[model samples]
Target chain A: MNLPRKEWAAALCALPASEVKHLANVLSGELEVRDVALPHAGLGLLNLRDGAFEESYFIGEIPVARAEVIVRSAGGMEERGGALIVDDRAQFARSIAILDAVMAGKLPGSVPAMTLVQRGMEVRQQKQIERKKLLTATRVDFSLLGQEDDEDEE
Target chain B: MSYVAIKGGKAAIDGAASASEYLRSKGSLDEPLTLAMIEEQLRLLTSRVVSEGGLYHPRLAALALKQFQGDTLEAAFALRAYRSTKPRLLESPVQDTANMRCIRRISSAFKEVPGGQYLGATYDYALRLLQLDLANEDPAAFKAVAKSFLRDTPETELPDNFPKVIDSLRAEGLLPPVAPSRAAAFDITRDPLVFPVPRSAALATMARAETGGLLAMAYSNMRGYGDVHPTVAELRVGYLPVMLPHPVTGELMEAGEVLVTECEVVAMYEGTNGDELPTFTLGYGACFGHNEVKAISMAILDRALQKGMQDGPTNPSEDPEFVLLHVDGVDSMGFASHYKMPHYVTFQSDMDRLRTTQQKMQQKESEATT
Candidate 1:
């Protein structure tokens, strides 16, 4: 689903972009939202950490772009019974953590395999970004295609 | 970027169930509760749950204890509340009275007739103090006692499934066809009772009626009002193989067995709808488990209500809906406990109405004085 960057960030935390859109629509009808923003962090684009407990989050000015936008939520009282929009990027990031934990033999069950697939997809996207940059810069969208994603470097 | 929402609504319900389970099992890891244990230890409570829940499985009631955390009343509430969500697995159609597997059968009639009277387990109207020894005794001991009684009277004739007393009346043309015709084929479990129920539904209602309430109501009628003295025409208690129609085979198949207490009472009936002199009419009772009191009370009420109809409202027992509906255990308990829930919304509405009425009354009083 299509989503703005701020929404994409929140979705990365928990919900998918499509679900976030639905929540936004529902909330807009119920209560007015003042503002939304995506803050910077030590990593590339500061994204919400993935966890079942974390849902409700905030995001501010940014327009929609490329990416499979899924809804996610910030972990908070507001997100207690709510949903948010997310994307494959955020899902993959979370899956990596799950996979890392599983490979370390800390996590249990099929959670590792599932997240490994997610991390692999994200790595493939990183490779495509490097090849794209070699070709042309004008065609690259930093947020969507992650033209020079910080995570790709590390 | 705009913040968007996410998550599944059903996850909340799962979380709730998990939380409930955790709360129930906290701390207690030993002496886990069992169905037989509940039936034996908490017999009265189990009986109440079964009576109200409209299901007679003691084990299910015990399982409900785990779900509701050993709160007998709440367990009963849960049992009934969950009943609506369950699909009826099988339908045990009405069996002919002559087909019942009679374990303990008896008749108070003369020495014998078609089937000789059998004293299955009669304290014989003697109210003896309940022996405390039997409370925690091994079940095998009780079985041995019954075995010994049977061995002592090897030649004693035991009555099988005696034909229904009502059938005999029907054959003699004493009772109107309206009597037994209504109950010919009935399934009470599947059907919610409609008001002014046919005799079939009425019988089913009494069959499953709670013992204490039923006995009280029946006794009230007997003491002064309805005057229904019914002789035990027949009584039976035994395990019957519960059969159901197979969807694939399209044939009857035995599911399992359930113990049942069945009793029928014959009372003198004055002719109705222009008939001859007074003849006998039947009051029948049957229920899950070996609850003879419930069965007998049910039989008494069955006869009283039918007989009292001739006398109108003067006979309180004649009101089928009143007796049948109110005497239900679960319905009674749920309704009684429901009052505890906050009704602030409805209460506020009533308070508003009362204020307006008071204002109106004050205005009228001043106007009259002026």
Candidate 2:
């Protein structure tokens, strides 16, 4: 069985909903989308390793959106697409899954879909870079804490 | 504990529900708090709900707070209800604190640590005076102040991660060696907690414990009820990345991150075996969102519980069952509020017993006097 992919869908999710919707609209015209099952928008259980014991256990639940689609082109080519995100929009997941199928199958409107995916990737990358810069700025250099050898005693 | 079911309160209950909605809107003074406002502006409060609720969805936590009019316990209960309806997807890959993208890191054990102490966003030293100007804060001024700070701060590329303070101590053989355990992971949501639960279960319980409830128990230990006086090894507040396996390919994929606070406390050391070198006992605490007090208190209690479990419990904090069963916000709140429910039969029976005893006492006194 062919697999439904997620990386592209994740990148697409980073873009604004309107942008994803626009691309999805352009490609969806030539596609017949069928839900492998109904999209799921609910909790995803978060587990963590206990620091002391180092054993894993349930910590909390995070909001999640998951969707799977079988897109059949007008010419009868089929491709499977799926996405699971730690967000709470089933509709967005469905739209991105459709886009994922378009990009993967290289179906009609694939170029525009690829462009949108690139934009989303760039957005995610920029956000990460900015976060890293701010976090690094706060790093401490404790060597500056001690008095210099030539300093006068108080 | 029997309950006499009361009928005919549906209409009154409906009226009360509608009245609550009206009061909530009125209490806002017509300036509704948006979910983003609640999530960002009311961060600590929202964080408390997220921690106590044991759910990492900040937006839903904000929504819960909005619906409950900022009642933390009810908001947590609402989160619990919301999560209970959802299916359990899968367990996440183990997250190591060494990889945590830290925003704040501090150590009380030593003045110098591997990662220089970064006191990122803390009010520990702030005087608890109320800011009168905040009563009518100007939004433009607020934005300007934040903008100016951001603009002025220079950015530098530094190491992506920091070393754990505990690692330095561990290398010196001062800290207890962590023996990797092969125990199966426990899900508190699914299974009934039997007595003498695993250390992981206890940790999970404390992770979602009510801050006040955990504090009350931990505070007693701090005031000399327990022998585990601890030094803070490390306390970190940061975002830990979440990774899940791809549904199809079975390869791990990053699934965003969750904000968390983690703490490790070192307690007094005792020899494990004859002629063996004594090492410091360690306790660990972590929870969703930023609650330093909760994390520290949990760390202390964690050490105490370890001592109790190992050498027999000398304090209530050391007792696993006592602490775990009582510290949950939802459980304690529910049990506390259950008194408001109609307990006519139980109270009436108590009254009957009391009246009978009083009548018997009167007869006995009269006979004796005669």
Candidate 3:
């Protein structure tokens, strides 16, 4: 399942210590996971899976946007970061965990704060889908292709 | 939502991620190392990173390795997924073999090429044993063995276009007439393969197919399946140029180079026409990265699948479904490894079926006894 960076990070960081330890164990089997500290960056880890790993960043006990996952291979390192977007329903289910945990008091932070963030992210995703629909709906305008100019002249 | 509610899925998933991280850390690395070290020190492995991962950047491969602490396959997967997102910078033109910068060149046809016979580095005549002497840093011994091989070599000018042996047969009317023009070849990368893929697509599918999967299928074919006798006509491994049209000038320009290995095989087949003459067809294979065995196997499989062949060959290569579907690393790796995820639901279903089957069998046995 493909999860957005923000949701993946939030899900990872907002876990209670028990859940964190659980994830740590699962990740450890196939990867050499490492934690790193940046001056302003929140807690994150270097996840080494399948002989390669990506750097994940988090903020304020919340997973933030713009977390770069760098993939290394034969030619070299490729850093990929983009909007916290998701395509698959399975991914959406996977991402809802941390927010759910926060809501259930299994994780830290004020309930309102976590709820607000969750709602905001969902709104952002909804807006993007609407924008896509709008663009697609209007994409067939002949004027945009410059054919309308000839019709007007005629 | 369905009647079945997924309880504690969030908690379970979160736990899984942490456990994964912990396991990866504990499993792989006992020492701390940076990406720079892997890139600089382990160049061979780094090359593997590119080829397997399908990413051409060594620096990135190194970083990924450092992050993963030498988990090569993981690094490769990460790279491959990332590679899909990157925009293509340019389209490379098909390179001609004549123009290849000969870092190493050899021919079975004559002793030497036009430039002169340079044995280059080849293991063909060698004893196939790993040289422990090379570990002792003996450059002199390396030169001595090379000189001995070239001693009786006939010096000759290399043909501008090396005549392929198959083409020679075509000229003599021994084989089917050479096409007036080279037919456009089908490639798997450009199109999804339907079953009964053409020779070109079949080769492409095999070329990048996972090594282990191909090896297994080839082994199956050799054990028994269909008629296949493979003789390697030629095998060449070297760098090939990546050229592209210059956006401004529109002239083809050299962009870079990638290493490749090509293997050609000849297999006997019944004539396509009504002549009833014994004939042979060609199997061709080429792949990114320097793996000749994979190429050779691919070539053998390619020729085996041609029409008008005897049915004794039982190899997996002779079966189009077996050969075409099982070679790609992506599908095989994903499907094979996905079994690691939770299968409780499937397992429960299996249990229910098993109990029912056993009850029915017992009832049949009791009825028979009565």
Q: List the candidate 1 regions with Cα displacement exceeding 4 Å.
A: A1-154, B1-30, B40-48, B65-76, B111-194, B245-253, B272-277, B308-311, B345-370
Docking quality level of the chain pair in candidate 2: acceptable
> lDDT (0-100) at residue B100 of candidate 3?
41
RMSD of each: 29.1, 3.7, 23.5
Worst 10 residues of 2 chain A by lDDT: A1-10
Query: Which one is best on DockQ?
Result: 2
> Model 1, B270-293: lDDT tens per residue?
665654556666676666666677
Clashing pairs in 2: none
The superposed Cα distance between candidate 2 and the true structure at residue A67, in angstroms, equals: 2.3
Model 2 bad stretches (over 4 Å) = A1-10, A72-79, A105-110, A129-144, A148-154, B27-29, B274-276
User: After superposing the true interface residues, what Cα RMSD does each candidate give?
Assistant: 35.5, 2.5, 25.0
What DockQ does predicted model 3 obtain?
A: 0.01
In angstroms, the error of model 2 at B302 is: 1.7
lDDT, each prediction: 0.49, 0.80, 0.46
**What is candidate 3's lDDT per residue for B1-370, written digit by digit as tens?**
1123457689888997888668657756557666766765576567555555544556677877766667766676776666555433222233454444333333343332233333334455689788776678666876676465444343333322232344444455555443322333443434787865555455545655666666666665556654556655555554544343322224443333445555566656555557556666556655555555666666666666553133533555677776778776667677777776677777788899999999999999999999
